[model samples]
Target chain A: MKSFNKKEFRHGLKRGLPIAMGYLPVSFTFGLMAVSGGLPIWMAVFISLSNLTSAGQFAGTNLILMGAGFLEITMTTFIINIRYMLMSLSLTQRLDKAMSLPKRMMVAFGVTDEIFSVASMEQGTLTFSFLIGLIIGPLIGWTSGTFLGALICTSLPESLSSAMGIALYAMFIAIIIPPAKKSRPVTIIILLCVGITGILKYLPLFRAISSGFRVIIASILGAGMGAWLFPIDQDVEKNNKQEGVNQCN
Target chain B: MQLERAFLAMILMALVTYIPRVLPIVIFRKEIKSKYIKSFLQYVPFAVLSSLTFPDIFSSTGNLTSAICGTLVALWLSYREKSLVVVAISAIVTVYLTGLFL
Candidate 1:
């Protein structure tokens, strides 16, 4: 058991290093933004530590600055984060049959896109030790970046800071565009959601829903529509066929 | 202190953030058994990413010119399946240069 734990830890460290490298610049931007928005270093670090969510933290911070109510913050965060539920649900199929409940719970908490991508790609039964490496590795990188960013924001000029802010959006594009290009349905879903959200921001009815509700309603509706149209059975068959080729190899 | 409210706000924000993250894990211990629910989960990422990406692409500079330049650069790079580092650096450089020019 100890040896297994060590192996898993080592594997996780290897997988997480690349992801941490990607996160550093992005989290640095988050930290810089937080400081520029008047947040303290400690608070900025705390946000990175607890939330560990880039988009949600950015949106939440802006809403707070806007003096948005708790309901608004809650709704916005929920909307932004609802994607994790999907990640978690898909991940369960990949977990070890004998995986303990507590470990699964802990692993679920660390389910970001990068982490999910890495973990999902792993072969064999998922273990708590593996999950720990996954969680802690990125956590260290993300928190340190934010902390350093907060400390150095004052020294950096506005132009440079603004440039760094684009990192998060860049990361999002990297994630969405690849899969979208491969699948017409995926592209449609993305365009549909963007169109609906754009309309909501401009339309009076959606304007009344608050930014938080706007995100939530748009996400739920978009996901619901996509699911109704493109069932997962098709994907499963596609994956199975691909898996067969791998097995033959 | 200038930092006090931001600190308080951060703590409140953290607590709010933890609830959403932790609740599903604690409550939904079993796999979601419903097929429809599973299908819904699959599409959420596309929707969320789109919603997040579009507004920022257009509004980051509060000007039409920078937004257009950045979006065009991003679209071109993405269409070619270029590495993210290349796409990001090109877009940022484009925006920064545009800002300097205008």
Candidate 2:
């Protein structure tokens, strides 16, 4: 019910720019895949508009293409997207405690991996406007990229588009490394995650686990291990303490 | 009929996906009090991002060499505390340029 905060929203938009750019190629590929798989162009675009997810949309659309049943599609999407629960829970820690339920719901819709990473690592309490601003650019990029890909059907050269694949991961690196530099705990946790994930991916014994499950196992083990090995000092964890008192009237 | 089925499937997918994302934030309005749990949540971002990056990032671009090249550039720029756009753009360009050679 409050007036929108233009400044924070602008900052969110600026921060979201890279994420938007990163989504372009991925969503573009999604559009191309869905349409080429025989879904109508509107359907492909609708999926991007409604879903705003990468892996889940891809998996779901793939199932749809194969004429998989609704329950099967639903469950597969859920498993692939279960990681968002951790992300949303983690993000709740950073959000302003006073944020209203509707506002919380709005921001929750935007909790993609890239958005969560950028917002989570952000320096302080996140305002609703800032979160909205952060989400809009990437949302537009994702939908528009889907539209373009579905419409054009691969005009960009393969090399250029394929190179864009690293953009989001690159953005992920940009989010984590700075914090890792300042905190030994952060550095250790990151290495722990990388090592575990690498093993899960490459080990023949664990080869049966899907990539989505690999992320979940690695994240839980890595964070759980960090919590045990390097319990943070309570005082140093006051990043959200000030905002706890700043509830809106 | 197929259109109706696909639409229904998408709606179902959206509902299931939204549930995981929305439930925790809505349910846990009160801040958690446990230190251990708080620490776990705190470390979640780093853990998730790192996990998402490794192995996957190595296979992100055209090939391993280009991906490595892009990853190193991203690491170097971000180590110096470059802005996200700068770091991202630099890495993309790095990958693109590296792709040219291969």
Candidate 3:
């Protein structure tokens, strides 16, 4: 209870509201997919509650439904969700130095792609309460969407479910657009990475590669290229940190 | 038997995913000093998300037109800085309407 910081908590909850809305249609589709694949509604909700990573959960569910080997499930999930490591690292760079170890671990559980993107753009050093508030919206939305999706998939028409499929990608594109326009390096990195992914996806040899590995390799290469060409100025970093500390006070 | 396997798979999936997210935050509590690593992290989201969005976005729905139109609308809205909820729901509606005609 003492952990609650009302102002930051309110801020985070507000921030999370949009993310929660975005997660609804996407996770609704995930629920439909899950129940069709033979998961019980509760189990689908359980997965949504426990594993917030969308791509990882989809792959893991596919395997589990197939009765794939545990080693396979683990290995597949590791490959798919490995990008979160990079995201977490980036967010750690963005976090307040005073944010504690226990707090870091707690928020780490909620580090989905959308959450990380939104949090990384925060202007100030993060407080645990704000972080919890941020995590809570998506957590509830994802779980409830799953429950509703599983419950209603049998009842919904095919066209409706299919239309919902595009919501996640639409949200991702929405997230990147502002930053892409604001930063030249980001624009170039996005173009280069999308091109690389296209090559990997379409070319005969690389088409066989799993999308998980493709994302990992493409992401690292894109970031590496951006780093090589357009490193963030140290003056800027210091300035941002100064602003963050000032905001903290 | 199947349920047990699914349960185990869920647990394992949770563990592996959790480790990746937790490890980096716990290991790097101090301020990062390296410019290269910092830059890499800075650009990771754009690059990863760019790759994630491509090709996949174009084909997520049944018809190409629905995906393409919805994506175009989303790009336009988000560029104008619409709320994410607005952007996503608008695109969803766009696709739904497009689906009716297609």
- Report the lDDT tens digits of candidate 3 across residue range B6-30: 8878888989989999998999677
Write model 2 residue lDDT over B25-71, tens digit each, in one string: 89977777888888888788788889888989988886999999999
- The DockQ scores of all candidates, in the order shown, are 0.43, 0.62, 0.69
Instruction: Return the candidate ranking by TM-score, descending.
Output: 3, 2, 1
lDDT of 2: 0.85
lDDT, candidate 3, A1-66, per-residue tens? 355689999999999998999999888888988998998888999998888879999988988888
Find the candidate with the highest DockQ and give its number.
3
Model 1 over residues A1-249: C-alpha lDDT tens digits?
Answer: 342487788878877765676678778888888888777688888889988877778888887767677677766776667666656766676566566667766777688876775565466657778878878878898999999888888756656556555555665576567667766667788888888888888877667765545556677788788878876675573573244211210
Clashing pairs in 1: none
| Total backbone collisions for each predicted model | 0, 0, 0
Per-model B-chain TM-score:
0.82, 0.91, 0.93
**CA error at residue A201 for candidate 2, angstroms:** 1.4
Per-prediction TM-score to the true structure, in the order listed: 0.80, 0.90, 0.94
Per-residue lDDT over A20-43 for candidate 2, one digit per residue giving the tens place of the 0 to 100 score? 987887788888888878889998
